[model samples]
Target chain A: MRRAVGALLRKDLTAELRTFESIPAMTLFAVTTFVLFHFGLDRSSLEGDLAAGVLWVTLLFAAVLGQNRLFVAEEEQGGFDGFLLAPVDRTALFVAKALALFAFLVVVEIVAVPAFGLLLLGPDLLDPLPGLVLVLLLADAGIAIVGTLVAGLAIRTRARDLIAPLLTLPLLVPVVLAASEATAPLLAQAGAEGPPGRWLAILAIYDLTIGLVAYGVFDFLLED
Target chain B: MQAPAILVRDLHKSYPSIEAVRGIDFEVARGEVFGLLGPNGAGKTTTVEILEGYRERTAGIVSVLGHDPGQRPRTLRERVGIVLQGGGVYRHVTVRELLDHWAHLYPAPRDVDEVIELAGLGGKQHERTRSLSGGQRRRLDFALALVGDPELIFLDEPTTGFDPAARRAAWQTVRTLAELGKTVLLTTHYLDEAQALCDRVAIMKDGRILTIGAPAELGVGALYRVVWRDAETGEVQSRETEDPTGLLHQLTSAALARGEPLRDITVARPSLEDVYLDLTEEPSAAASQEVRDG
Candidate 1:
């Protein structure tokens, strides 16, 4: 099972690297959306709840672009059938795909977060760097899990493009909520502050619970 | 004694509005090449998919290598390889990279280089899949299936659209699998393909097997077509008869005595293609006859 997961993950990352399919598009979307937020509110800088809301919302929608293309090569090229033919555990596919999406999210954040800092963030980006990274990582995990599951489900339908984001946005509302709440303090203009521990706990629990649910149901989606 | 490679009895499968497979029965012996010959919508794919454990059967029994495929156990998957018709390969990866990746999925896979050679993909290994021609991609599909070193392989419509040379090449690949002592189950609509590759074939239509037999045996009673031109009016005449030799002898003897030889004379036996057409075209009669034979 581990070998299968490793092979699958490596293939996804290799394809992404060769084609630059998911990450570049996702990163570009994030940066472009940030610029839009800057002008849409006509605000020179954002802080606290407003800043946190803008960042997570833009990231969540950008992640949707990643989710939409997640299973396309597999679906178009019969990758799912190839994977299903193997003797390994099916859950390994769920793990590999979720992790691949997680990696893409992290890479996008690596660039997008800094762009956010330079463009519209009022706080000294270095002051809240540590806590903000934690919040971003946790939120990315939640998005990755739910996004993988929804991507699997939506790919089976003809309306996958229209359906993936429709399904993903609602399911990811909790992650967005928890992540924004956690980052609000760190981005506060008054000074850097540690995020309340409860939001982190909520993000962790959400990841675990949904991760279990996605893992359990993913095998069925692979069939037919 | 060891059981057959595949044993399916009274199998039935239906979708919401259609009965895709209605109680079909057949068995393929170990190391044998079996084909399900049918036209489009003849339920060939549905049956093969059911055997591969991709879809569930609506009724009856199915056993592949002495195991129920519906359960899709890991051991069964480890032993069975499948080449789904037009199943996609990752276009971004090179041929060697893709094959190496698939090889790891199996416990004891064939060497990737050997598999590439076996599938006739030796020189193109370094090229990305998207760069390969259509025929090359199909060869890649075969390579992926063979990478597992499986005991039984399922090929659903392996060569539906191919030029004459490509089709023959595909046939050679199937022959290679048979030489390796692997049991193969393939579905194809090409009559010549079935005759050239399959040891035995089951003709199917409208969710049922029309008839199953060795290619030569199925045409045993089918007629031969004899055509010739008449000396008197220079017109062409043809006849379908059970005995082409007797018919030819009579015509030639009369023509020799009359001092004019027959023109455009040709006698052709009914091949497997003829048998397939006869069975598939007249479904109602054939189905009842099969039921009575049972």
Candidate 2:
């Protein structure tokens, strides 16, 4: 199972690296959206709750862009059939795809978050770096799990572009709420403190619950 | 004794508005090539998908390699290979990369290069699948199926859209698999393909098995045709008979007695296509009665 996951992950990462398909588009979308946010509000700098809201919302929508394309190769190319016929456990595919999405989210955040700091963040970026990283990673995990599950469901439908975000955005509202609320304190101009433990717990519980549910149901979706 | 590679008994599948596969039963012996011959909307794909464990049966028993496919037992999956009709491969990846990735899915897989070569994809291994022609894509599908070295392989309409040469090539690959002592259950609408490749075939229509037998024997019991022309009158004549050989002997003897040959004499046996059309054109009275009874 480990070997299967590794092989799949390597294939996806290699394809992404060669084609520059999903990650670059996602990153570019994130940075561009940040610029748009800067002008939309007509604010030179944002802090506290406002700053947290902009960061998570921008990242969430950008993550949706990556999720939309996550399973396009599989649906268009017959990757699902190829994976289904193999002897490996079906959960291996769910794991590999989720991890691949997670990796993409991380890569996008590396650029997007830092860009957010330099562009519109009023607080000293270094002050909140540790807590902010935790919040981002947790939020990314939640997005990756829900994104992969929703992507699998939506990819086979006729209205995939509209369906993917529609299905995912509602499912992800809790993650966005928890992540934004958690990050608000770290971005406060008065000082940087660690995120409240409650939101982190919520994120962890959401990840675990969704991850298990996705793993359990993924096999059924793979079936005809 | 070893069990048959596939044993289906009184199988049925139903959708919301229709019954896709109505009670059908057939068995494929070990190491034999079995063809499920049917037309569009004949429930051929539905049955094959059920056997492949991609879909569930509404009723009846289906066993692939002695295990129920509905259970989706990993042991069964490891032993059976499936090449689905219109199955897709990744368009952006090279042929070798795709095969290599598939190879890792099985515990004991065939060598990636060997599989590529076996599928006749050696020269094009480095080309992205998107660049492949339709024939080449079908070959890649075959390669993926064979990579697991399964004991029983399911090919659903393996050559639906191939040109003559590519179709012949696909046929050769299937024959090669049979030659290697593997059991194959193939579904095709082409009667010639079934006649050429299948050791035995089951004709299906409207979710039912119309008849099942060796291609030569499938519709043979019905009648044989004797065609000839009268030498003196130059009039062509034909008759359907249960005893073609006896009738031909009598005609030849009479011709010999007259010191002349039986002009334009020809014996015509029903091809599988002829039989398939006869059975599938419309459900016979007896078959419809059976459906009503069920």
Give every collision pair in model 2: A78-B88
Lowest-sum lDDT 10-residue window in model 1 chain A: A215-224
- Residue B284 shift from truth in candidate 2, angstroms: 13
**Which runs of model 2 end up more than 4 angstroms from their true locations?**
A188-202, A220-224, B14-22, B219-224, B229-236, B241-263, B277-294
What CA RMSD would you report for each candidate?
4.1, 4.3
**Model 1 per-residue lDDT tens digits across residues A105-205:** 99999999999998899988998999998998899999999999999999979999999999999999999999999999999999989998999999999
Residue range B74-145, candidate 1, lDDT tens digits = 999999989865564898999999999888788999999999999999999999999998888888888889
In candidate 2, what are the lDDT values of residues B106-160, reduced to their tens digit? Answer: 9999899888888899999999888988888888888988988999999988998
**Candidate 2 chain A, run of 10 with poorest lDDT:** A76-85
> CA lDDT of A75 in candidate 2?
82
Q: Whose DockQ is greatest here? A: 1
lDDT agreement with native, every candidate: 0.91, 0.90
